[model samples]
Target: MLEVKVKAGVPIPLDVSFQVAAGEVLALVGASGSGKSTLLRTIAGLYQPSEARVAVNGAVWLDTGAGINLPTRRRRLGMVFQSYGLFPHMTAAGNVMAALEYLPKPERAAEAARLLALVNLGDMERRRPAELSGGQQQRVAVARALARRPEVLLLDEPFSAVDRSTREKLYQEIRNLRRVLNMPVVLVTHDMSEAQMLADRMVVIDCGRMLASGSAAEVMIDPAALRGVGLREAGSVLNARIVAHEEDGLTRLDTSAGSLLLPRIEGAAGAAVRVRIMAHEVILSRDAPQGLSALNILPVTVLALRQGDGPGMLVELQAGEETILARITQRSALAMGLQAGDACHAILKTMAVAQDNVGVMQPVI
Candidate 1:
């Protein structure tokens, strides 16, 4: 586990504390210059805090009160930055071999080759950074980082430099690597979809303060939390399993709320997936409508009602073990008699489910 507690410093003038368990990915998400990268640097021992305590497992990396601050090299951490940061003069194999200099001279070559193969870059080991594509260079960087066999891994917007297709492929690679490494991973990203896809837990920071921290599903569904960080469009996330693919260009998903039919998804049957439901896309009705073009409708009980800053209102609903949110005008909410404990039906159009809002669920080990 990784524990961090910082009072205030040159990085960010705010108090923050959090713990990340082994094999879990904790994402730091916020606008640019929100101190997300600063926190990661602090944890990696690249930055000194005014007062802080950082630890991993039973080892203490920084204790300002005790005058103990380990250097970056002594922290045993693997970090992949936005830039690949490869040596222009060296081949991919050479770059990874540099990280294994502590090994015996005879063992370095074989170990470097093994690490390259682990990252699926064995065939490209002899290629230099200039010859490799953006994705390949990032893969080489990852291989070099893992060559050290560090205790934790830090990724700072590692995929932002790649194209959409390349980013998607890299996402799958990171998911697979997580299963093999099973170490704590901390990622910094501004893309909410990326955070939803890769992070087990997410921390929203803004103005040098942590606004919210929880499971991605929990944090995304909470309007107050999202608004605290200045995200206006509130949404909810649901875990579902792809049950079948209809011949009529629709896919069937089974969630705790019920069966949901949406536009065809890219995953095969039996694959676990996460779906994001935007609050503004949902329509609540006191009575179930019989004739509607909407393909998805679920019975839900109102959990709470929150007034927004404008004329809108947020209605929280509970369907089975899952919670969903709907945004409606205050006048419409009053007309529908929306109140806590009232039962209603949530209507959503199939087309509103965007491709980016769906992602394969990462297995928890």
Candidate 2:
């Protein structure tokens, strides 16, 4: 496990404490200038905190009261930043070999080749940064970071510089790497969809303070937590198993809420997946309509209603054991006579469920 408690003033005034279990990915999410990067740097021993205690597994890396502080090299951390920090003069193989300096001189070349191959850059090992694309350069940086076999990995917006198609490919590569490397990982990102796709748990930070920390499903349904980080839209996540693929270009999933149909997902039968349901896409009605074109409908019990600044209100509903949120106008809510104890049906169109919001679930490392 990786544990940290820090009070700092150099980068940004921060009072933060959190723990990331071994083999778990914890995402730090917030807007710009929210101290997410500062916290990552502090953990990597790049910045000394005014008061802090950082430990990994059973080793203590920093302790202000005990006056024990390890230097950056001593911490043995692997970091990949937004800017691909590769040597402009050296080839990709040379950049990775630099990190393996501790190894025997005769073995460095072969080991660097292995690391480069692991990141799917074996063919581009002889190319320099100027000759490669933005995505290829970032891949070299990732390979170099892993050359030392570090105990923890820190990624700070590593995909922000790449294009959308390249970023999606990188996302899949990272997910595959996590299964093989069973270590603590802390990722910093401002995109909620990216965080939900990559992280097992998420921590929302705002102005150097941590507002909420929980499973990705739980945090997405909590409006107070999203509002704390200045996010206006709220959504919920559902864990489901793919039952079968229909001949009509639809996939069937079995969720706690009910059986759902969506556009064909890239997965085999019996595979696990996570589906994101946005509040605004849900239509709540007192009675189940028979002539609707919607493909998914579930009976739910209203748990609570939170009024917003505008005419809309957020309704919390319980479908089976799972929680779902709906954003409806107050006038429509009153016309339907929705109350805390009322029974309602939620209607959703299949087209409203975008492919970007769905992800194939990965095994816990």
Candidate 3:
């Protein structure tokens, strides 16, 4: 587990505290220049704050009260930056081998090969950073980070440099890697959707202050956290299991709310997955509407209602044991007399959920 508590007055004020368990991915989410990267730097010992306590699995890396501070090289943590920081002159295998100085020279080559293959880059071991694609270079970086055998892994917007198609593939690769990496992984990202898809839990930060911390589902449902992740991007994440691929090109998923149909998902049936339901895409109805083209209608009970200064309202609903959110006009909410404990149905179009909004559920390590 990784425990962090940092407070500073100068150089970007930050007062954040959070914990991440082993085999868990905790995302630090906020807008650009929101001190997300600063926190990561502090944890990696790249930067020191006025006062802080950074520990990994009971080992103290930094303790202001104790006047103990470790340098970056002394910290047993691997970090992957947005830029694939690779030696252009070195091959992928060589880049990974550079971090294996502690091993016998003869054994380094074999270990590098093993790490490259771990990230599905065995064939590209000989390719230099200049010759490899962006995703491949990122893979090389990941291989090198893992080579350290670090106790914690720090990912700083690792996917932002890749294209959307490549980003999705990397996301899956990270999901696959988490199964074997038995350490806490911290990810810093401004993209809420990415955090929702990849992180087991999230720490919402804004203006150098921590707003909220919890599972992606829990943070997204909080109004305070929504402020950190712009209200425009607010949504709920539901855990589901892929049941089957329908003949009509949709995939059926079994959630607590009931079966949900979405555009064909990539994984095989029985795979656990997360479905992101955008609040703005949902339509609330007091009565089940007939003659609708949409096939997904979930009977839900209004859990709570939050209205902002704007003309819109955020409605929280309980569908079975799952919590869903809907963003509707305050006028519409009033017209329907929506309130806590009121029974209603949530209408969602089959196409509303895009492929990017779906992610493989990370197993609890």
lDDT of 3 by residue, 1-365 (tens): 99999999887899999999999999999999999999999999988999999999999999999999988888888899899789899999999999898899999999999999999999998989999999999999999999999999999999999999898889989988888899999999999899988888999999999999998778877889988788878888888998999999999999999899999988878888888899999999999999998989999999999997689889999998889999999999999988899999999998999888988754333
Error of 2 at 45 (Å): 1.8
RMSD of each: 2.5, 2.9, 1.9
Candidate number of the best lDDT: 3
Q: What is the C-alpha lDDT of each candidate?
A: 0.85, 0.85, 0.91
TM-scores for all candidates: the values are 0.90, 0.87, 0.95
Error at 114, model 3, angstroms:
1.2
Which is better, 1 or 3, measured by lDDT? 3
lDDT of 2 by residue, 1-365 (tens): 89989887665788889899878999998888888888898889987778899999879999988999999898887899899788999999999998897899999989999999998998988999999999999899989988888888889999999998788778877877887777899999987777878898988888888878898767765666677654344777777888899999999999888999999987778877878788889999888889999999999999988787678788889987788888899999888878998999988899998886777754333
Q: Put down candidate 1 lDDT per residue, 259-307, tens digits, no spaces.
A: 9998988777888888888888999988999999998999999999988
Candidate 3's displacement at residue 8, Å, is 0.8
- The residue ranges of model 3 lying beyond 4 angstroms of the native Cα positions read 361-365
State the lDDT at 237 in candidate 2.
75
How do the candidates rank by TM-score, highest first? Answer: 3, 1, 2
**Which 10 consecutive positions of candidate 2 have the poorest summed lDDT?**
224-233
